[model samples]
Target: MSDQAQSTTMTPPAPSDFDGRRAFGRAARIRTPRTSHAVWSPPADRADPVSLLEEQATSRVPDLVPVRHGRMMVSPFTFYRGAALLMAADLATTPNSGLTVQLCGDAHLSNFGLFGSAERHLVFDINDFDETHPGPFEWDVKRLVASFEIAGRHRGFDDKDRRAIILAAGRAYRERMLAAAESTVLDAWYDHLDVDTMQAWLHDERQAERAAKRQVKTFDAVVAKALTKDSMQAFAKLVTTDGGQMRIIGDPPLIVPVEDLLDDTDIDDPEKAAREILASYRNTLFASARHPLSEYTYVHMARKVVGVGSVGTRAWIVLMRGRDELDPLFLQAKEAQASVLERFLEPCEYDNQGERVVRGQRLMQASSDIFLGWQRVRGEGRIERDFYVRQLHDWKGSLDAEKAVPRGTLLYAWICGETLARAHGRSGDRVEIAAYLGKSDAFEESIAAFAEAYADQNEADYQAFTAAVADGRLRAVHGL
Candidate 1:
């Protein structure tokens, strides 16, 4: 661990008085005033953004690095999606209130989405945790608010409209955190926002008109579509019958079957190796011998490229059948690397990176996938890697931010802000955070200003990234 990590890991004093905690939060404003968040001046010795990306590519699969680059090159918004490390480095230079939380370290707009909770209800929450780690609360706020600015610019929103959208999100977070501070601990813990609530809110909030009706109808369709996206849906799309057996389809750079990737020399028996991997993963999910996972028999496994920043990382989809061929279960095992925030903040306490992600997700979300678990796997040359496993899809969906109008984007931002605040309040001192924010627009307006400035920085970084690709410093395969 770095010295910084060691310093930050010191235990905070235990709580004694409620007013004292609020005083502590208010005192933080003097140390790192809300207005200090508005500035964004790059240090002279700052690491080149492209260089940071290149360093990350070193650990990834060489063939898929270009694909990752391709996705990020689509727009400044896309580049921002892949530039968590770049921003982490930048954020480290900013002043913080020392109010720490379990951060969704890459908490951009697209990362918040709808997914089925264990109760089988579609809930809206932070959907990505690959970079989750303990960090300053403002780090997540900065990332999220800035995403709206970047995305707003992409959609050609006017300056006034963009600022309005960013303010709406910031205000939502502050108000939600304040509300959480007033509630009983258990009540706050149990708080969650589901899709049904969102739909109802839209009905109550929207003006009764043809345009509003169309927007509601569109969102309703998105929810309907998400409901159909489960294991059975994946089974119909990605799995096919091969002679007398079932197997995952091969789509070279995106999805390649395990057998296609490993020859006889790589492993004595590919099927046996896949089964062993599944068995090891099963142990992480349950202690009971008669667990539901025990009923499923592994049939096939495939390496799949996934996400904007996560493209080159090793991700695999495993196919299993319970009882019969028609009863399918798809599990995704994704490699978990050290969080991008680890270098800037404290090192994760969990030795297993996968466990770090799993624990963080469980702590930060109101409800999580039942199959969420982690394990270590040994590859060729005995190289050990950590991986977190979850259902491949259980009503997973995200708002189409790219296609949304200014009004729609503003409301979406409000929802994302509320969701993020709930996640933060779960693991952080809500009283202090709420007190620090107080009843003022100072923090909200400062964050909007910071977001606008950072969006400029992101665009400059995006230009440099594109230049690197043009000059062959980086390779990009577009339209992947």
Candidate 2:
């Protein structure tokens, strides 16, 4: 298909009012142990991807006080990427079982990773939940499948191979969900994948693909790099002298120093104000039953530019010193707002969105960061937004997407499915979703088609964004 013709055909469904229940029926049949769960319908107009993204971004504006103006003018693709929550909203309003647990709305391959669990084990699971909300489990599965298809295309995989990968992922999800449904709640909750367990799992499979083994080795190396004190020092290299005072690089929204962003505030003393904020954040940590910062004392705070999608958003890296200079803890306080799922979901009663994310993360992951917690801050006027805090690099690591092979992708998909099943097992024990999905390859085929369509849409959006950047519609600094 011609690129322009494809663009015209790829225009996603316009935002419209939708009946969530009807959409669910169209998407899949919901089967429960008893009667099927009642599904809430969202308006059809709200399902439009463009509208949903705009709404999600609008809601976050009030809370994103650090860098104003130019931050919002990014290219269309950049904006779309940042607005994943909107994609969640669109997906949630689609047909789904009302059996909802906390969901990692953005359950793409890149979102899964290794992090320090409370047990001190490096567990792998969903690492991002910026759009987490109570919704149908199928939404996450579909999104993940679609992401796989899109990523596969990006890697130049042929259609047949891409379909195989999607099917493998879906089958893995269905089979694992069935197993989890049969397990005790505690057993399912405790089930997690650590490095050793993952290695063993691969070893037993006896797959002789050198490329796959190399990917595993790379993951181990990356984890090793992040775990050492030397790596932390490397991060400190960003810190430089500014007028005789130590400051990290500040480039507007991406990397604004805390002092510059909070300038003209009534707090008189920037350091003191930062300390008070840290105290409030610490209170949140204490409430979570996991204290990663208990041994450390707050020493400094700096604005940090992070993630491809979250680059322009307000994020901070706080430095804490314990025992001495050699002992340090780095905490990330990331700004949070209502997830893209919010508009489509029933209004949440919780006042803090960050807490909502943290709680959802705890529910979805077999293990989570010890310091995960939420804090509410009044930015300007009465505007309020939630912020979740976590240890910056507590043995946390991820695979480099560019280097991942097809089999590596397959293994990653399997792990993702297993993890999703565990998360779904928590809220509803309906073995029917698993049964309906069945051992057959039909569901996977359906998802493969869906992924191809969605990926085409993503490419179109990416192009639109790049065009916007070229036209000077948005200010963007890449490769930071």
- Maximum-lDDT candidate: 1
lDDT per residue as tens, model 2, 1-480:
111111111122222312332233233443321112122233445544434334444543333422322332333323334657555644544444444556687777778877777877667778898878776676787778877777777677787777778877877887887676456656766766787787666665565563366666766686685455332563475455567644466665555666786663323554675577767777766453445466777666777767655644567777677776556667788888776666666676578889888888877777777678878766445555568988777776776655666777777777777777777766544353554455566566666565666666666655654555577653345434
Which sections of candidate 2 miss by over 4 Å?
1-83, 209-213, 229-253, 264-270, 286-294, 430-432, 470-475
The candidate scoring highest on TM-score is: 1
Model 2 lDDT, residue 162, Cα:
76
lDDT values of the candidates?
0.88, 0.62
In candidate 2, position 258 carries an lDDT of 65
What would the TM-score be for candidate 1 when compared with the true structure?
A: 0.95
User: Residue-wise lDDT of candidate 1 within 1-480, one digit each (tens)?
Assistant: 323222222234466567777887888788778998888888898899999999999988888999999999999999999999999989988887789999999999999998999888999999999999998899899999999999999999999999999999999999999999999889889999999888887787454442376677877888999999999999999999989899999998899998787741134565786687677767766454656888999889889989999999989899999989889999998999999999888768998999999999999999998888888876666677788999999998888877989877878899899999999999898888999899999999999999999999999999999999999999999987
Q: Give one clash count per candidate, in the order shown.
A: 0, 17
| Cα lDDT for residue 383, candidate 1 | 70
**Model 2 RMSD in angstroms:** 8.5
